[model samples]
Target: MSYVWTLGEQFEGKLRGVSFELLARGKKLAEELDTKVCSLILGHNISDEDLEELIQRGADEVYFVDDPRLADFQNETYSNVISDLINQYHPHIVLAAATTIGRVVMPYVAIKVNTGLTADCTQLEIQPETKLLLQTRPAIGGNIMATIKTPDHMPQMATVRPKSSRPLDKDPSRSGKIQRIVLKDELVDTRAKVIEFRTDDAGFVNIEEADVVVAGGKGLKQAANVKLVEDLAKQLDGVVGASRQAIDRGWLSYPHQVGLSGKTISATLLLTAGISGSIQYLAGIKTCENIVAINNDPEANIFGVSDFGIVGDLFEVLPLLTQKLAQAKK
Candidate 1:
């Protein structure tokens, strides 16, 4: 039987949020193609409850490989297992999150399986006539969106960006089958050993995962003014974001950059000052919930997409807003 499969990712025994998001996307595509949605997870010591959560979210079948050797994310082993699974099952389509793991493992799997892969797709759809997986992603420095399709490949593979779509609410009544798979010793063998893992404490919040982001653009005028953005973000219990222009001027670090060339954020609230929203910047925040723009020029492009627009100087507006939030806090 044909199946639409989503590769689930886990860290330290708990499933990542992107797993459910991919399942939600898979469910829609499976329905369109008249196939069942299956979720494949590879990890050690994964809980049964977590496996069951896949069904509650939207998978018709959950196939998991739990082995001690597969504990950490070893690219060689992961690519081997995933490629072997695709070979054995011959799924019609494969979806994974475009996170660090996905970006690293998917290309290897695609090469091993002799199939094409589209990375960092923002949108996915099943073409009605041919039932092809249409993968849409930014190209040419985010100036144009390119739609790709693997017409001849058995499993059309794509890695979608996290927060590109929301996961469906859990349904306790949803019933599905969970199966355990055992891989051959050869598949689990790896050449490299992960001796230790280290985290970078750069003191910069991951803007892509923030619930609220207050960004400054070139309109902030100088590096010192970036503090204004940081202060307001601090007041709102949010993280600071920056447009490409701001980052280009070295007002903020690259980690805080929000755009197609940088990171795509799905914050609940996005507030921008002095940013004349270019299409590249807009693509990064297309999924954001509420957008507020502040620009001295009323004709600024950012105002077009903003739910609230303020035609005033950011230097004047930011301090007042920050003070008001501070006063409200007191």
Candidate 2:
């Protein structure tokens, strides 16, 4: 009866970007199954302002659980609370954002609830014949795609990677119902404790939400030349990305790095500079709508998969292309 989506905490009571995307996708799946889209917002002392907005976005019902002591994140407490909510709703499907919190909590909840959980799913569909949730994920080191289903489970559970699915277009006029669920404060507190936290200036851009991405790889000779990649991305009004090698060398932020060891993105226009397009890198970005690759090597592996291929040194080509685009804009 319920397609429940979990919304994680951000700055204060704010919703993370990926949480909205999950709600939009959950709305679609709910509509397909003729069920209501219910969102479970978890955090300590979340404002009604936040809960009300989630209902407006797409959720048919909002379940808010709040406590002042629960402000800081401790995996055990949060997961236990969410699991309790699932038990009450008995939802048919449960979706979580494949974020650091969701990733840790989902696996734990799945094992506790005795259900199968799919992590980093790029695609999801309800099978017409069986009504089984067909969850798709990158398999075999991102070389192949695998679709999995838990036939005997009541509420199908899965965590989807951020930016893989776009959020529903905001409709301020949209209306829905909000239902605050009972929280077992005693149980949740006893289950977990928060000692301290560490914050890193990972980045400002939610690269997953970017419509276009320009990424650089190992071919760009030196760390100083990484600026070329950023310039091109800026020209396109898109985010900049890098390959595993670039990140490993401390040339780019870990969040900006794309490959097996990093995040996955499905931007509309993915422009690659100097990247050789290794299978691992492609695994993260294969879902892009239009891919443009530039490499000096005519026989680069990137050419085999790129929709548009340009053979040239990225140092020479990137500046020219950025200038051309800038002039066109002017």
- Over the stretch 101-161, how does candidate 1's per-residue lDDT look in tens digits? 9999999999999999998888999998898999998766445789999999879999997
Cα error, candidate 2, residue 108 (Å): 0.4
Q: Over all chains combined, what TM-score does candidate 2 have?
A: 0.89
Per-candidate local distance difference test: 0.91, 0.80
Worst 10 residues of 1 by lDDT: 197-206
> Whole-model lDDT for model 1 versus the true structure?
0.91
Residue 92 of model 2 has an lDDT of 84
- Model 2 is weakest, by summed lDDT over 10 consecutive residues, at 2-11
Task: Please list all clashing residue pairs in model 1, or write none if there are none.
Answer: none
Model 1, runs deviating above 4 Å? 202-204, 218-231, 234-237, 244-252, 278-283, 286-289, 299-301, 319-330
Best by TM-score: 2
TM-score of each: 0.85, 0.89
